[model samples]
Target: MFKYRWVFIIVPFLMFLEGCRENFDYRDASGELLFSKDTVYLDTVFNSLSSSTYSFKVYNTSNDDIRIPSVYLKAGADSGFRLNVNGNSGQAFSDVEISANDSIFVFVESTFDLDTLSSPSFLATDAVVFGNIDTQQEVALVTLVRDAIFLFPQRENGITESLPIGVDENGEPVSIEGFVLQDDQLTFTNNRPYVIYGYAAVPAGKVLEIQEGSRVYFHEASGILVQQGASLHVLGSKSNDTEVMEKEVIFEGDRLEPEFSDIPGQWGTIWLAAGSTNNRLEHLTVKNAVIGLFAEGDPQLTPPKTTIVNSRFLNSANINILARNTSFYARNTIAGSAGQVSVFLAEGGNYELLHCTIANFWNQGPRSLPALLISNYTETSFGERSTSPLTKAQFTNNIISGNAGIEMLFDRDEQEAFNILFRNSILQFDTNNSDLLQNPLYDFTDGNIYEEILLNSDPEFVRDAPDPFQLSSSSPAINIGTADFISEAREDILGNLRDQTPDAGAYEFQGN
Candidate 1:
């Protein structure tokens, strides 16, 4: 009788323990699954090019472990959209589980063929459908698909050779097997965008004239090379007041996705060979490249190697304007946000920047260089330095500022003549040191050399908005420029006329 009493007590305790376990609720509801985003827009992908993977999350807000009865693409197996639901890649998935208060990821990718479509450019769209008992939801997928003229290095006999770029640090000519533009291919109209696979070289005596509103996209390590005696003329006009998109010539990476828009070092440099001359750029925008402009001109030439006006260079990995033993003239130009120096005048050069802005606020990485660097000597591969004369380095009504303490570095060899002049410009150099302030390099006391310069004062820029380089209303640069400096062209970069006493830098100060 005692044993029977103990068994009954244990059975009751076991029943109580079973009742203490938590219960799960699996009722189907319309809003049971929460999505990270309602839509996913992929980049403008070329024909036959694989797109980058885009992902979204599906969260189970319900208290129970919810099992999605079906997850599939609305377009089914023949659709361009490929879906991977919780690690399983297929047209459809069944019984996809998400634990209570947990989430699962769904990745999508696509590869489109333009020949399959009836148009040159089209919008590819589909939908990711999720279903359960009496409930359904969807997330839209959209991508811009285009047919582009892809240029790549031709392979012969199973060997891919490159074109001759230039001299290396050892003073040796380096050659890579790249595609050389033929005489017929020199002119690029406002047709569909050209996607370059390797470096594109304009042969000697050829001219590559890009018309207005032409878009040129370069692949990784690909750029345009103006060979010796070749010319590059980019003729772009200011956008119409009523037009939504600017008519400026654009040079950027081939990737049109949002993530890679601001990424630097996407392509190589636009290199002007040693003897390349008569190159001009107007109303152009070059961004996300290794180097925006690399001009190596023959020092013997009298006229400027290249002339740029009303152009902008943004997000270069290294120097935006790298001129070596060259002559370049720029007006109403803005160049900045480089990994190293924004404008590097190395091995001596002749440069005149008028009403231009050279500022480097590169927050992408650790930048040790300045915004403007002028060096008369270049280090060779043998650790020896070769000195070149900096005939004329002039900055008038320009703004030279950056994150560095000293935004301008003038490394002059004692023997070589370093002729540099900063007139009516706002310089971001520390003047706290009495000795530095007194020095002619920092101070503009010498009438014949420097004059009317503002040192170490903030220009009060409008930082990282639509126009980051524009001067605010309270900027010290306003009404501080020499009226006679910009006498020829009364208009600033934005087509705004300068006042009697103009503001400095590329822009005229319109009220806040």
Candidate 2:
């Protein structure tokens, strides 16, 4: 009876333990980790160009840390494209440290040309793999295509190429005065190489006429610095414009701002040095410059009048006009984009604007900085000159728009010291914001009194889509203007003379 009771208790205990084990064991399995998105494949073809450029991006969307060791293009990794990871030679870019669920741009560019790179075939043939190690896991990214637009673990490479100018070899100077290219209009071909290092001091008595359709390319450090008693005759027309191109001029150096030494004239400024004066640039297109024109220092002694007519200054980093005491007569000019101001009134510069367009200028772009800019740097006292240091400029019949953020800033109570008279001008908003009709004009003394135009109506333009500055028929811009400060103005952008009353702004609607 005792043995029977013991056996019974032991059997019941074993049965209970067996039931609990089976209940917890449904199934056990292992799964592979998958990428959030599918791999990208491409067939990139670069035609007509000797070299090509490419960029990519990388993303991390996991809670665990992702470590990238290297990246490489399987096919001809060392031949077609070279890995410049953090500016070093490695298939893997950098040891990127991305917080969980964060991403960054990873760029790749080719060092050599891939003549027949265009289809998925190219990406497949040139497919690359990234090696990453995280928590002792060996992971491989096997791309599907021969050519691919792969976003990997790397930062975009901003490598620059330099133009060869006079350094090891002696350079030649084009006679600014007597220097005449056989063709009135010069074109840059593979041959006919001439570099103007330092300054292009003009020779006296001869007018250096640059005909319309003429092209002038500058080395990074190459520029024309007209000395006193010298002049430049830039002849261009609305139909045929003269081109002063910044040939491969970039503004990146080891220093804060680029110097002339690394790539001489890389800054690419058309500086009419203080002593240099009496220059003429008309119907010209000056683009991609550090400073379009810098007229600085010794205003009292510089040339009396400097004329810039019908010129387009596009995409400059700083002031288009850095004039001082220099009498400037500008007409039908366009200054915009990343430039400090269309014209910088520094060191007491005197200027007159007629039918000119100044808009979309400030510190913003790939080459940009964060700083509020003043429209004109008007000074009440520049040096010891007792002469009205801050002479008011006459901006008659001009279209100054899209620059609401910047104000006509004053220096030492100078906004009231002098005036920036805007007669028959239109302060309008850009298309980016349609409801707003004008710029936020202001004065230190006036405050909101002259803040902006309250019309709030569309200034129906001739063409409203792209360049909407042109006025339409039945528009308010016609014959609603002020009298001329110097001479009675004539000829609008359409070549129509001023009527009984001039238009409100730079353009008068001929169709209207």
Q: Best candidate, TM-score-wise?
A: 1
Off by over 4 Å in 1: 1-34, 60-69, 94-102, 116-120, 132-136, 156-158, 166-173, 431-440
Q: Report, for all candidates in order, the number of backbone clashes.
A: 7, 32
The positional error of residue 434 in candidate 1, measured at the CA in angstroms, is: 8.4
The sequence of per-residue lDDT tens digits that candidate 2 reaches over residues 1-512 is 99999999999999999787545432211112233333332223222112232334445556544544444555544535434433455454534344346554433444333345544233222433455333221222222222212111112375322222223223453322112222332322211222333334444433455555444444344455555555566766543122744222211211111222222113456666454456677767666567777665443433445677767665666655556545566776666554455556654545667767665435353322211122233323433322334454666666555434322333323443344555665554223433222333342124323322322234455544343456677766555565553254575543456676666554556654
Candidate 1 per-residue lDDT, tens place, 1-512, comes to 99999999999998877565323334344556889999998888988888999999999987776778788899997788898999999889987878779999999999887775667689999999898646889999999898777778988899875886667876899886578998777888766778887889998888999988888999998899999889999998885487556778999999888889999999998999888889999999999999999998675466698989999999999988899989999999999889998999988878888999999999998998889998889876688988999998988899999887788877878788788988889887753667656666654577666789888789989996587899988999998888876675588888898988888899998885
Backbone clash total, candidate 2: 32
Q: Where does candidate 2 have its weakest 10-residue lDDT segment?
A: 248-257
The lDDT leader among the candidates is 1
